[model samples]
Target chain A: MRLKDRVAIVVGAGQSPGEGMGNGRATALTFAREGAKVLCVDHNLKSAQETVEMIGANQGTAMAFKADVTKEAEIKAMVADAHSRWGRIDILHNNVGVSLSGGDAELLEITEEAFDRCVAINLKSCILAAKHVIPIMRAQKSGAIINISSMAVITTYPYVAYKATKAAMVSFTEQLAYQNAAYGIRANVILPGLMNTPMAVDTRARTFKKTRAEVEAERDAKVPLGKKMGTGWDVANAALFLASDEASFITGVTLPVDGGASVRRG
Target chain B: MTRLAGKTALITGASSGIGRAIATRFLAEGATLLLMDITEAVVEGGEPTHKILDVPFFQGDVSNEKDVDEAVRRAALPTGRLDIVVNDAVIRIGKKLTDTSLEEWNRVMAVNLAGVFLMCRAAVRQMLTQEIRHEARGRIVNISSQHGMISSPEDVSYGTSKAGVVYLTRQIAADYGRDSIICNAVAPGKILTGKTGRAVEPRWLDYSHARTPLPRLGRSEDVANAALFLASDEATFITGENLMVDGGWMAG
Candidate 1:
């Protein structure tokens, strides 16, 4: 009941046609379990609906909405629908990201079209959503924004656009926290490392032409702790802490939900 | 629901300030507790945390190896396992590099750096012998300060010792993570722990207010909440992270 009565909008609340939970879906569920009225928004109406149904099965309040987060109009509409339904937005979780499957590759090999799409989906979406939600948050004099970046921002990866945009997110979140402190709106970023989610394991398996188990084992070997990759629950629980009042004094933090991967360099 | 139900915890410097607050929060979270501190006297002058919470208290210095070993031994007595250990014992010598005496630097390092090392070693040894629960054998929560990462304004010894703490936390985490032992640190920003003297000086207070982006300074409870999160099952996949409970101080 940490987020009791709080209204949360979880962007990218649908997984990429997977068997288990994605980061966004897991966050939506975690928020609901903690008593938040979650607005599950995704580009896929059916996928979003599935998330809503899962929350409902657990006796949690939620609704499904369709929106291309890259499009300002759809994002605005989604926010308006939530506001009209719940009255206020207490939490905004930006959980969308794309890598190899999204045409992400090395600098020279990456195409202009691929780069633009990656930026729009991964970076612009977060900015536009924040732009739409900031006014509402300022009007209420309180809000928490949790942005999901990747450990690729720090660790080496082949994707040029993904790395640049994700790194920008960390800086953008810091600037947001600085500019909006007076409004009582807090913004932070989570850099998840080698999580056992569709975005990480499943996508890599599809793109790299390997079995899911092979990709999972490769990633697990890199992780310093437990010799295994983290789960969607790991990222979701970190998001829960950032979104809850328990982190009232925390803002502008770049928390790594990696099981000791980032700590090795230090 | 109790977040730490059926867990046993050992907390150092639990008599006052952030340590005392963590002790209180842990007890409320259903953890069996054993508190360790050099003295039973509260820095803010109140009832002893041990007596107030009705938990066993080990009156000993964290820098002493034997004292740390005994505290861990006592913490695991009832459950035969130490689920969590918080290395919160710290000493700050409010002197600049030039003015700080050799004795002052050593004293600060002993409690803040070596003390954490000793406690973590003992806890890790004890944890290795126990069965893993909730995907973790044991968790270590170290109380670090934001000053170590950036700067601590005037105090040199304190900042250097804290820098050591932050690094030590990572080293232990990287080394012992394969054993399912989680280690993390909570780096608190300017928190008002009801401490007097150097901590509450007008100059430092003004500096803190200027640096913090929040509307107000932090409370000890704020740091305690973060420590509790790291110590609990909710943070199973998080290790070697220096979580900043600062009011956006580092961000700004």
Candidate 2:
């Protein structure tokens, strides 16, 4: 019961059409399991509802909200809804990301439309959520923010928008942490590499027209540890550690849950 | 469930400060423990950690290869396996580059850098013989410092030694990943270990507070909690990482 009585808001708390749990859903569940009452937010209402039901089966407290995060109004409403219900927010977990599904491509092949959408979804959503949540956390004088960036920030990735925006997240977190430390707000980012999640694998398989096994194997071979891709639980666990009191002293760190791939590059 | 259940662990410099805290945390988490330090005396003062925890204590210098090997050998005798090793033994001269003598520089490096190498070597040898458990044959956590990545203000030798530690951690992880050996470091920033020294001096304390973003300095428990995470099965995919437990000092 590390997060007992705490109120957590998990953005992008739904999985796309795929075979495995996504980072946001797993993190939402992990927070509930540790005694935090979680607010699950996603664009897909049904998927968010499904996650809430799973938490309910475990006798954990949770609620679901539908919001298109790229819209500033929805992000603001989502924060207000959680605050009005719980009176205070203890944690904020941002886990939304998209690549192939978002129509991302190499620099030459990328379109202006695709670039704008990626920035709107991946970058703008996180900033607006923080902007709305900071006031409540400041009044409370305590909060933890865990942003899910990507290992593509450091490693070689073909997509420009994903890499550029993800890299900005690391900088944004550090600035956020420095600015809000006096208010007792801690912000850190997790860079997950080659995870076997619905968004990570299924989107690639469909867009690239490759078999699921082929995509998994290709990503697995790139990892330095166990020669296997990590699961959604890996990202969830890191988020849990950062969100919990165990990491109270830690802030503004760019932690890579990359199976040692980032280290190999150094 | 205990996170460290069924694991056999060895912690160096276990008599005081961060090491003592780590030893206590691991034991409570169900690790079969061996506490190694050059002495039984606690720096912050009280009962010896081994006696308080009721674990075996080995009084030996980490710089001595024979002493390191002996500690590792005895730690494995009870279970025939050493699941984790924490290199926390460290010495600091607190001298400026010009003020530091050759003798002063050598002592710090011997205990800080070379000592980690010896203990890690012995532990890895034992780990290589054991079967993999929880995606790791063995795990090593070296207590590093934010000073290594940045400047240590005035302590040159100490920072240089710690920088070596951070690099050594990466090399070991890269070489041993195929063997399922995991190695990482926990970098703490301005932790107040309740020891009386230059660390607690008003000027230094004020300096740390000015540079650190958090309202207060860190406690030994903060570093211990992080070490526990890296040593536990929960950190399955992480390796060759130097996780920071600083309250946003390095971030600034």
Candidate 3:
């Protein structure tokens, strides 16, 4: 009931092949279950439909839409479609990100094509989505933007473009919050660390040709709390708090959804 | 629907302002509550908080080790465990470093910094003996101020104490992660809690307005809501964080 009657749009509402829930799917479901009507957007229409179906099974309100968030025109149309369907937008969640699968590499090994794709998917997509959603939120005079970034921005990571683009998200979110506070739009960023999601653990397993258990065990050892990795539900719960009225006075914060890893670093 | 059902909690400075709001929210969330304050009287002028909530009240100073230990003991006696503790008790001298006397500096530090230490130590000691629930032995939510991260204008002692609080939160989280003890702080910005005197002076109000990016100042409930989040199971994985409830003030 925290988000009762609100309208939310969750971008990247699908995960690459995985066993359990992804962050965006979990967030979209959490918001819907809490009474928000959700529009689930993803480049893969079938995947977005699957998330919508899950919500439907639980008697939650949600609809699936397709969009390549990196394309400005597609992002604009997605926002417009959501606004038209719901009549107003109250929340925008940007959760698209990719690393090795997107052809990312260390600085010298990285290709121009990989860098551009990384910037487009990880950084520009968020900016473009916010650009299209801000005016509608300004008219409504109340909106919450939750951008999903990675903890790799602060910690060591191998991919050059991924690190740079993710770091830029924190700065962009701050600027968005600074300029839009008067408009009643609150913007915040979440830095997820060593999550056991399909996008994180599964991707790493496939990329490194290791077993899922092997990848999970390796990541779990790095986390300080219980020596275990966190779940997508953990990130979903944090997103729920940031998006709800409970966080009315909070804005422009970079909350790390890590298991004490960020604090215990030597 | 109750988020904190079956949880026993102790909240200090529960007589007024943000503490009172936090006490109210915790009750609504189905927590068995014990309130402690230096006095029964509310600083912002209202009925005593414990009487209003119809809960048990422990009158004590947070800086005193005996008072802190007794309060924690009383809070845990009913349920044999303390699930949540919010260190909201703090005193501000509101004087610049050069203008502050030794007496003024000592009072603020004792109430703000030393108080947090005493309470956390007692709560952690009790928590170490309890069974973990929902992946946590206990959760501590310390009420820090945004002034700690930046300058507090003229209030040097108050800001320094709050800075210590932020550091202490991180240290506790780092040390106690293996014990399932979660500690975090909520830093409020320009909150209007109906407090009078130097806090609401026209000059200070003007300065706050200029710094805060939001159109309006914050309410006590704003801080309380955040405290409730950190206290609840919703924030199980988050520790050692100083969450800013500053309406984009720090962002700018």
Candidate 4:
């Protein structure tokens, strides 16, 4: 009810086969449940379709759009298509991300292609999407943009490119808030910590050389409260609040949804 | 069942405003309420134990060791367990550094910052002494302000004290997370409550609404909803975080 009649676009909403959901998919469903017409966008058509089908099954209005967010032309087309279908975009959830295998590498070990790819997908996509959507939002004089960040930026996650891009995203959100406040456009970031989801599991297993169970157990032990990792729904719920009118007075801030993980050692 | 059914909670500054709102919400959520206020009016609304709820009121200065100790002792007597502790009592001393008196600064810091420390010390000791349950653990929610994270040119003492609460929350979380205790802070911005009037000075309200992207001030209930989340099992992985329930004011 909080977001009644709002049109939301959740980018990177592809579903991974596993127990927990991804941030994009969860956010898409959450927005739909709260009465927002959602457009579930992802690189994989099948994954986007899955989220769309779930919303449809629940009698919520939704559609699936597949596009590579890293490409400007694709992003522009995506926004235009959304406008054509929904008439307006009231909320944009920039949830695209990828965990690359460049952790703790020396400057020499870092490849140009990897760094470029990381910046494009993880950070530039947000800028490009905002660039395309800003005019639409300005015309309407109201909109909310929720960007997903990682606690690794604050903690000891030694992925140089990842950390730099995520940190820049925070600054991006702040600048966006200041520039667009006049038009009633709000921008904020959500920094998730040690989440136990399919994306996390796959990333840990592939990058950290740990089995699924080991990665989960390791994550749980590091968390101080409940001694466990959070779910995608947790991040989704936080995003829901931030994107909804409930957070109408909130902008230019970063909300940490980690279960007390950042404060564990500080 | 209540979100906090069968649990005992101790709330400081329970007499009015945000503290009172939290206490009322806790009661509605089924927590056995232990109310504390510097003034005797905290218990003035009614006698302790109204209907089936055990509502105990304690009058004490949070900064005084004896008062805090006595409040803790009384709260622990009934259930022999303290499940939740909220440090929400703070006095608003709206003044710049040059205008603030030493006495006023000391008094505000004593109650706003030191008082929270004393209460947490007592609550953590009690939580460690009790038998641990499987699903349920101890919770501590500190009421900070958006001023803690950002600037508040009008109120130096209040802002500094709230910033201290942020650090204190993190310190407590680091020290006790190993013991199954969680600590967090809620920072609210420009909230309208009983203490606030709808007729805000036109210029200030206009500036605030304009600066806030949402184009409005916050309500106390907005903060209470966030507190409910942090105090519930849903926030089990959360600790040492300062959740700003401000309507995007800090975001700007």
Tens digit per residue, CA lDDT, model 4, A229-261? 888888888888788765666678787877767
Q: Tell me, per candidate, how large a share of the native contacts it keeps.
A: 0.90, 0.81, 0.81, 0.55
Q: Provide the clashing-pair count of each candidate structure.
A: 0, 0, 0, 13
Worst 10 residues of 3 chain B by lDDT: B89-98
lDDT string for model 3 (B20-99, tens) is: 99999999999999999999899999799899999999999999999999999999999999999999999987788899
| TM-score of model 3 (CA atoms) | 0.99
lDDT score of residue A130 within candidate 3: 97
Q: What is the TM-score of chain B alone in each candidate?
A: 0.99, 0.99, 0.99, 0.90
- Calculate the i-RMS of every candidate, to one decimal place: 0.7, 0.7, 0.7, 2.6
* TM-scores for the candidates: 0.99, 0.99, 0.99, 0.85
Question: After superposing candidate 2, which stretches have Cα over 4 Å from the reference?
Answer: none
Model 2, B39-74: lDDT tens digits are 999999999999999999999999999999999999
What's the lDDT for residue A1 in model 4?
Answer: 73
Query: Model 4 Cα displacement at A116 (Å)?
Result: 1.4
Candidate 4 similarity to native, TM-score = 0.85
